[model samples]
Target chain A: MNIHEYQAKALFEKFGIAVPKGAAAKFPEEFDTALSQLPEGTTVVKSQIHAGGRGKGTFKSGFKGGVKLCKSKAEAKEVAGKMLGETLVTVQTGPAGRKVQTVYFTTASSIKKEYYLAILLDRATSRPVIVASTEGGVEIEKVAHETPEKIFKVFIDPAYGLADYQVRELVFKLGLNAAEQKAASKLIRGLYTLFWETDASMVEINPLITTTTDGVEALDAKVSFDDNSLYRHPEIVALRDLNEEDPKEVEASKHALSYIALDGNIACLVNGAGLAMSTMDIIKHFGGNPANFLDVGGGASREQVVAAFKIILTDPKVKGILVNIFGGIMDCNIIANGIVDAVKEVGLKLPLVVRLEGNNVVAGKETLAKSGLTITSGDSMADAAQKIVKLVA
Target chain B: MAIFVHEKTKILVQGITGSFGARHAQLSLDYGTLVVAGVTPGKGGQFFEHNGHKVPIFNSVADAAVATGATVSAIFVPPPFAADAILECSDAGLDLAVAITEGIPIRDMVRVKRAMQGKKTRLVGPNCPGLVTPGTGPKSSGGCRIGISPGYIHQKGHVGVVSRSGTLTYEAVWQLTSKGIGQSTCVGIGGDPVNGTSHLDVIKAFNDDPDTHGIIMIGEIGGTAEVEAAKWIKANVKKPVAGFIAGATAPAGRRMGHAGAIVGGTEDTAAAKIAAFKAAGIEVAVTPSDMADALIRAAKAQNVKLS
Candidate 1:
């Protein structure tokens, strides 16, 4: 689960991280009022979206007509109206621009220090890593490529909490003064507290900047929580914006299944977590776009398979579904019944490609073939992948 | 006979009265595994029946292990109490412990890992489906997941398979069984970073077993455990081996289910491990169906036959 930038900042501000005050507006008219609310100076206007690459689209296109110095309120309103609802090209959307639903306007601050900060899962260590960098305002990935030494990654001890000594050292490495150092420590500590309390998988603040002797504030924030841990956190659940997510993904999560909506036409559902991923990859390799990754786990029953098919059919973009089951302990016949039941109940009409292996594979193929649902069975994975790819193509 | 667990390994359930715990414990005891004791703090003195015998209940791991001489512990505590339960089990000097609970804090596992080190104790999972010594011990907890796969899928043979994926292990065992291969033992090492032992740990035990012959390895994309084991297999293990990896192209951006099952982690993606295995001249299966053929080919290629 991921939260928007403003929501994360609100949490940080509540924890006493001094952040610049700003208002979120959806239109250029709201933008003008938002700018007027800030101190009469060069104000920074940022696009608010769940994904990155706002500047590459709307902000540059909408806000760039002319710099109208508004000493009065009237000038701001007219300028705001033009920018409202206007689509602009962002790096995210390519030449096609993403719609700007909201614009954040705030008084720009003097940055004496800039650093990168994020809490991400380090899979090798299976630990949450607190990565801080002296170089701020730029994407940390670039720093990783150009100057890897600048990034200092500290693996947080989830049991003991973030070590205070490590906090002090991180502050020192960032080259902060006494006052900034204290504030940074408080921010990092508070961030950790928020991370734990909310069960966040990641909390990122790019360009956590220190103003000239004033205080440190988060320039941008991104928070991601463990979906499995969401049951323990009601507050995080209330903050979830259904509008910011893929509708198919939202529906899939309800079934306790992991679904990543892709730009593919093949709706692939496979049993076993590992096999599901490979199924998707094979679909892609066979010149078909995979619409999702659905894992029915190892012991997927007829019911689970039905639910998986329903989830895939929900996506209109799906051209067909490829059902790949490598029969382990999970009976392939049970899974075939699920596929038959789901198709039967939902009146599903998409082409189905199935490649089954192991126990009762023959019986499973026979069951599906007799189900009378445009079913295609392959003796091998390559054959299955090729059939689906051709069907969609 | 499987190492670490067999018919004689006395078992104890840490949360015997819980729903999933008691139910699975019943299933396990029925399967012929000797379950001597159960432990649930404050619920001590209560007893449960397994394998036609009434087992004594205790309040702590030490009490259970000591009183019953239990060597293996199965923990069904919820996430919040998981670390403490494992620690207590470790302190009891048990030889092996399985923590079937999920969402354990990394710090807790680290401490548990450190404390269990140099001792006779080994921990299986902080968040996983509990281990099963099939046909030897009772499948203890309802959630500990015995026979989540079909019981008949295993042929009861000489191949010892170790994997980080719990379900995949069931899948591999099923595949091996269909090909007329019975497993000496199947181990899910758990995908948690702080969880006990590695692929190498189980492989070492399998290598020492005279009954165990060829091995089949199934790994997901994440961590270096599989890669590291491939290297070890290349150097040591006098057995024919073949491998398969799931999530071959798990989008570079998207992650797998377990926080630990990511294939795209530091120097160990599924591609990387497969590369290492192929470089070591190991036959890698392209799909689950191919696993049987690959393992068969590896055996023939090595001119090795299981007795």
Candidate 2:
């Protein structure tokens, strides 16, 4: 759903939003080629990753600053070399961080002023809103919390697009000069169009700069599209970076199961999203950390249950597995049998706990009991969590 | 006596010829819902027989509505065509349209919401578990089940249950039902990032209902809906309310199962919503199991007869 900064910038350019010339390079050796496309003066080498706070992020190689201001192509090459193959740890990226597979090299711009601009769906209003502020190059969340008055918002009516008066008010509140205001209005309009056209969930340009040379340019870009709408846009789906996502998650997606790996030893497999979260919460509340959050969905067939178990077992940290299902449309017998089959196939070594409720629950429990597997079946959620915690702990 | 659908509310099934649509349609009909008509493009004049009874299928919602006089529609259309189905139902001047489809693109919903500005239809769940009114009319034998949740989990009682998650709604309802605390009606506003109905809409309906004595509201981390609902309850609702929120231990920035369950900002968290509920004099359930007990206690304190 989230695209890299270079990809976002490319989208910005495609939408007629001015952005500095840049090229993405996979290797340090290709830095020269990328730099040649830029103004050849001062270039900014930005590490390409999904997480924000990259400027302050440190590379695993002990190279400071994910973003490097390089005066020479050799310096850019050195920075890119240090970052291209190294793992980056930012405030946004967890302690384990993401491996930087690509680096963006772009021409540095002379900025007279910086402004924060983003277009996101506001939850309260249930509409797409444009958020702008005079403060830039800092965490907008912190700015909003500290100086709430500084942040200005304009909610867009999706039916009519961004209203003319709304854009005019936003630009005026941004406090730009006459010519700069004109350009800002055009840029904001184009960005809104891109947001609507591409079905983007968020389009953020931190430090939308009023450059000394150009009228306006996006210094940094982060864009995420609505995943549900991706079917209508095949081109957007192709931009998904498999490297940036957890392998287990991507694999789970292929199987239509929702899985997010966590740092724990108890792997949880639940039927629904809400139930899955409650399962995890109960596991944690009972003093057991869940290894992963996995929801097999409502209508999971036996094959999908098997696939979910396989995905959970793939995480070697899993010391115990808890299968908590409240089958409605999902059959309990299929899940119970699938667990037995998956355990037989994967050669289950970890302690297993099973809890089945809802329709066909008695049949499901009977199926599990008849499977002759060493599974601990619990009566309730609390009982299940306690049993799993005791076994894992 | 229920908030949304009851015995007299004639139901129409959209996308009726499809497997998903037909499955739930049959289930709804079997549950004693008066499913008079079905809509499937190009399947006009077809009959979908269920339990020895034939329900007529039409090419469009307008034709289906005109023929069947069905005011309520349950949508089983796929995600891509779901918005159009809602629009069609809305365009036909249906009273309520329950959209059971999940993964509807927010863009399409945005347009759908815009088109519904002054429309007669009230949309529920582009990714929700539909509404069920358990305690009204003769046909409410299985409680007029229109959504995905099993009818066996519900009973005819005074508590009004509204939730954001479907399975969780079932969990809460099952607990309430098993403990002899039957529900008057239960509604899943849905767990999509952008949905049609909200806790406020459903709670307002519950507040106006004469059958609903006390209410059990289930929310998760996301949106300011719960917080806003708390404020509304403080101002308007007279009934005793018990609240439960899932995903208390969920990690920040993680989409805890539901697309709409993400913690977007500081205000949209379990802690924040729980605090808001407490501030509004609503009983808060700490754990999922505690929800039924909490609601019972709240109802007892307010002189609500649970049995």
Candidate 3:
């Protein structure tokens, strides 16, 4: 659901929020043309990736800085050349890093001061909260932890939308001048509109800078849309970059499965989200590391089970698989049959342990027993987890 | 003696004409619940006949409530119209509205919640398994089965259960039932960030219920609702409470299937929630399997007779 900085800035412009003129190039050949679109000034070359900490990131080609301030257009093009098609390793992007499929070039502005601003749901209030701070261009969490008072929050009433007073309060708290306050207020309102209209989960602008002309702008934009609301906004969904996501995860989503790959050997397949999470926790508690967390949802049909099995097998790190189902509404027999068919289809050699309970569990267990597949059945979740961990070990 | 529902509570299905709604409606009827009516907008004046029960279908919640005297509604409407369905129940002044539909937009829920601030109806979930109060009959068939939870897994007893996840709640209930323990009522508050009820709300209800002797609360990594409930339990409630927090192995910023089950701030992490539970004197289950045992330990320490 996350969009790149360039995409976010494009969205910001649509909402009348000021962002530095920028252009993106997917190839080195397009880099020169992209740089040409920017005004002749110190240009900022940013590697396009979904993760944060891009400025501090390093490319795999021994190139320094995923984001760099180039002195000229030629320099910006050179930096873009170095970034495009190279893998960027940021703090958020793990060791394997994200490959830079696109590079953005923006005109670097002279900043009088930097400020932090964001709009997201405050779960406690069930309301959208505008978080602003005087300290910007750095991690807001660090600021909130260290200074605390430097950070200010304004919770918006969804019924009334963002109030003028709330914006003024934020502007005043950030110690903006009259000119800057007017621009900040307008920018904040526009940003909130973008957030609300587009069904954004979060809209963050780190280092929201005020130029020497007292004009406020979003220097770095990070926006993520609410996945559930994506159906209403096809335009927003079109901005999604499939290259940034793991292929296994993408494949699982296509099959309506929720899967997040991890570094362990024991793969977990559970019926519900909370159960899937706890399945991973129990595996770890029993001295086994979980390789992934996969939820086949409430009604685990045979095809979904087969698809899940194929996805799990794709992970060579996974030495064993554990299927945990509390079949409240789901029929346990269907799940058992799916497992039997999946094992036969995939030629699965990994240790498989299943703990099936609730609704027609007797038939489910009988089916598993007669499968003649090397699948182990445990009496309980604990028993199943223990069995899988031991077999893998 | 259940907190929200019982044997005589009249239930209605909102999207009864739909496959999902009809399927669970049949299951509820099979479980011997008094399914009084169905609401499918245009399918009014029709009867949802299943297994010798001919439940009337109405055009609106108001019409359905007036005609059938149904006090609670189980909503299985699609996400787009689910909010309107809940608002309808609120307008009709129903006692409870359990939303079983998932994938509702946060914006819709936020507005629905705001609009229902002073309303009479209590909303349970938009992506939940619903609530169940066990009956005394074979496989607990006569109880009030509201949503998609399997009624046979429950047993009529004193312990109250509340959870965010459907299967995890079942896991705890099954474990308790396996140990010859029975539950007074089990409630799933749903896994959305903007749900109708919170852990604190259910915990308070369970604490106030005279029949509910002990409680099992299963929460995942998310909002401060669980922590707030634990703190309240520490101050006011004398009833033994056992707590289990999932997503201990979950990474930060990853949504674990459930829209609400994501680690955002430090306070919402599994470690943080577990610490809060321990600090509030709630027995924290080390693993999901130990949920029932953890409650038993808490009950033993407090000298509570949970059935």
DockQ-based ranking: 3, 2, 1
Residue-wise C-alpha lDDT for candidate 2, range A273-347, written one tens digit per residue: 888888888898889999988998887677887888889988989999998888766677877788789888878
DockQ of each: 0.37, 0.74, 0.88
Please give the C-alpha DockQ score of model 2. Answer: 0.74
Instruction: Count backbone overlaps in model 2.
Output: 0
lDDT of 1 by residue, B159-254 (tens): 777776665666667666656666776777665655786777787888888878888887777677788788888888778888888776676546
RMSD (Cα, Å) of model 3: 0.8
Model 2 / residue B264 / CA error / Å: 1.6
What RMSD does each model have against the real structure?
A: 4.5, 1.5, 0.8
Q: Pick the candidate with the highest DockQ.
A: 3
TM-score of each: 0.84, 0.98, 0.99
Candidate 2: interface RMSD equals 1.2
| lDDT ranking of the models | 3, 2, 1
Chain A of candidate 2 scores what in TM-score?
A: 0.97
Candidate 2 chain B weakest lDDT stretch, 10 residues: B135-144
